[model samples]
Each structure stands twice: as C-alpha cells, then as structure tokens.
Target: MRFVSWNVNGIRACVKKGFLDYFHKVDADIFCIQESKLQEGQIQLELEGYEQYWNYAERKGYSGTAIFTKIKPLSVSYGVGDLDTEAEGRIITLEFESFYFITMYTPNSKRDLARLDERLEWEDAIRTYLLQLEQVKPVILCGDLNVAHQEIDLKNPKSNRGNSGFTVEEREKMTKLLDAGFVDSFRYKYPEKTDAFTWWSYMSKVRERNIGWRIDYFIVSSSLADKIGDAQIHSEVLGSDHCPILLELEQ
Candidate 1:
C-alpha cells in the first residue's frame, strides 16, 4: 500500500501549478493534503476511483485538510474526540479494516508565537486521540505537522532554533507523540540523512536554495514499522512551498 502526504498551501492555487499532473503520475492509494484553505462548494476535483473526504474550515480560506483514497473505509470521522478544535477543520479520520487513517493540519504558531499555547493544547488533545485509536488498531497519521522535531530535520538548525516551528515546546510535543507509539517513516528509513526537507520558505531564493524544514510527515504506529517498504521525499515536485512525501508498506 502507498500513502502520500503534501501540504498544497491552497488547492486552487496549486491546481494551476500542475498539481493534477503530479497527482495522476504518483497514483497513490491514499493521497492526503493539508492547508487546503478551502470551503465547501469552492472546488470540485474529478478524481476517478478515489473516495474523497474533506474537513473544511468554518472560516473561508483558512486551514483545512482532505484525503483521496482508492479503497473505501468502513467509517470516517472529523476532528479529534470531543475537542472544540474542529472549528478550523484540521483533522479527518478514516477507519479501515486494519488501520485508522488520519490527516491533520497542525495549527501554526505565528511568527510572534501568538498561537503557541493553543498549539500545545492541540498537541495534547491529538496525542490522546491518537492513543485512543491505537487501542483499536494501528493508526496511519500524516499531514503538515508544522514542527521540525529535531535539528537535523531542517536546513539551518542553529539559526532556526526557537522559531515558531522549531521552538522547544513544539518539538517536545512531537517527541512525546512519537514516544506514545508512532514512528516517523522517513527518519526510520534514513536516520542520518540531512538537507532533505518538505516545507520551504516562500522568501526570495529560499526554495531555490533548498532552505526548508521537514515539517510534514507520515507517522505510523510503531507496530507497523516492519511493514514499511520505503519512505520518500519528492523534493523535486512543486506547487506549494511544500513538496509531497510518500510511504510504501507491504500489504
């Protein structure tokens, strides 16, 4: 089975930049996107043979997520538990026979760290939610998690430290989540690889120079670790500032 995740920035904007072309070429069994920044009825994607699911933010053109899967799931859900955080449409969960698939767009802590506290609360809530789902079956979680868990996950560790996405609190939350039983598929395969990143800054020459952060991820239950076939970063593909990442697992 193949799972792909990418933060499209904005689905509408990305479409014009060959999103569909790459989407068709990859042909992932399950394709998930974050930061869709869309509302209901805003766009329609003709994805034949794939069941589309979306969680649109209440506010127009804000945070959102979606999944397009070739296989039908037994059940589906939006949000994490009874949390009131769904207002931003950040999460979507799908229950298959053997796994619970979830995609999320983690809240960003603004440059001034305005949303740091709220982001931390979300971390705790989602961690608890993931654990609950893990009890039933292994979970496959993917999206723009919005944090670089370690120094090696970004381009300039020293300079980027304490920044919105690299703050100690944010990074620790990610560590705690992984300690709870998830495995970052890419790092699992390439433990020491450097300069590989997912999201790059939109500033001048940032993307061109490859100054980016590996904020997006494909995290699976630790139990599924051995089933992982390969984890890939399609840094060459572009539409948004973020590129797509893929994980292959033995079915």
Candidate 2:
C-alpha cells in the first residue's frame, strides 16, 4: 500500500499553488493532510476516486486535518476517545480490517511556549491512546507532529534548541512515544539522512538553502516495521511551507 502525508498549511491557499496537480500526480492510496485551516462548506474538492474525510476546527480558518483515500475504511473516528480534542481538528482515526490509520495535527506551543503544558498533555494522551489501539492492531499514524525530534531532524539544531518545535520537552516527548512502540519510519530507513527535511521556514531563501525541519512524519507500530518499504521526503514539491512525505508498505 502507498501512503502520503503533508501539512498543507492552508488547504485553500495550497490548492491555488497546484495542490491538485501534485495530488493527482502522486496517486497515493491514502493521502493525509494537516493544517487545512478551514470550516465546513468553505471549499469543495473534486478528487475523482478519493473519499474525503475532514476534521474541521471549531474556530474558522484554524487548525484542521483531513484524509483522502481511494479505499474506504470500515470505520472512522475523530480525536482520542472522549478526550477534549478536535476542537481544533487535530486528529482523525480510520479503522480498516487490519490496521488503524491515524492522521494527526499536533498543537504547537507557540513562539512564547504559552501552550507548552497543553501540548505535553496532548502527547501523553495520544501516546496512551495509540498504545491501547496497538493492543488490537497495528497503527499507521502520520501528519505534522509539530516537533523536530532530534538534532539531525532540523538544519541548525543548536540554534533552534529552545524553540517551540525543537525544545527539549517536545523532542523528549517524541522520543518517549517512539520508545513506547512506534517506529519513525523515515529515520528507521535512513538514520543518517540529514538533508531530508519536510517543513521549511517561509523566510527569505530558507527553503532555497534547504534550512528545514522534518516535523512531519509517518510513524507506525513496531510490528509494521518489516512492512515498511521506501519512505521519501518530496522536498521539491511546493504549495505550502511543508512538502509531502510518502511511505510504501509491502506485504
């Protein structure tokens, strides 16, 4: 199976920049997107054979996520069970016969780290939730997790050390999550690939210089590690500050 994930930043704006063109060209079985930033009835997409599932933020033009899949899932859920989530449309879980596919939009702590505590709480809750689901079946989770997991994940880790997405607390939380039972698919495949970043700053010449962070990911249950095939960062694709990452699974 082939899967692709991207943080569109804003779906509407991204569409104007040839999102559909790339979307058709990629032709992933499952296409997941984060940071949609739209409300219900705001925009309509005509993706021929793909079924669209969107989790819109309660606040208009804010955090949101969606999944466009050619294969229909057995069931679909939004957010962690009974958790105070998805008010910002941060997550969605689609259940198939063999696995649970989740697309997440992790909350950012903001420039001042004002939402740090809330972000930490979310990490804990999501970890617990994923573990519980892992007990039943493997999970394939993807999206803009909003953290540069390690020094190699960002261009200048030393300079970004205490920044919101690269902070010790944030990075450590990601470590704990992976340690729990998940595998960071790309890093597992290419541990030494320093230049394969997914999200770049929109500042002048930042993307051109390849000064970016691999904040987006395709994390799967350890059990699925053997199924992982080619994991790629399509850094050349442009629409948002982030590019699309693809993962292939083989039986």
Deviation from native of the Cα of residue 109 in model 2, angstroms: 0.7
TM-score for each candidate, following the candidate numbering: 0.98, 0.98
Score each candidate by Cα lDDT: 0.94, 0.94
| Per-residue alpha-carbon lDDT of candidate 1 for residues 174-223, written as tens digits (9 for 90 to 100) | 99999999999999999999999998988999999999999999999999
| Candidate 2 C-alpha lDDT tens digits along 1-251 | 99999999999999999999999999999999999999989999999999999999999899999999999999999989877786989999999989999999999999999999999999999999999999999999999999999899999999888999999999999999999989999999998988889988889999999998999999999999999998999999999999999999996
Residue 188 Cα positional deviation in candidate 1, in Å, after optimal superposition: 0.3
Question: Candidate 1: minimum summed lDDT over ten consecutive residues — where?
Answer: 78-87
What does the lDDT read for residue 23 in candidate 2? 94
23, model 1: CA deviation in Å? 0.8
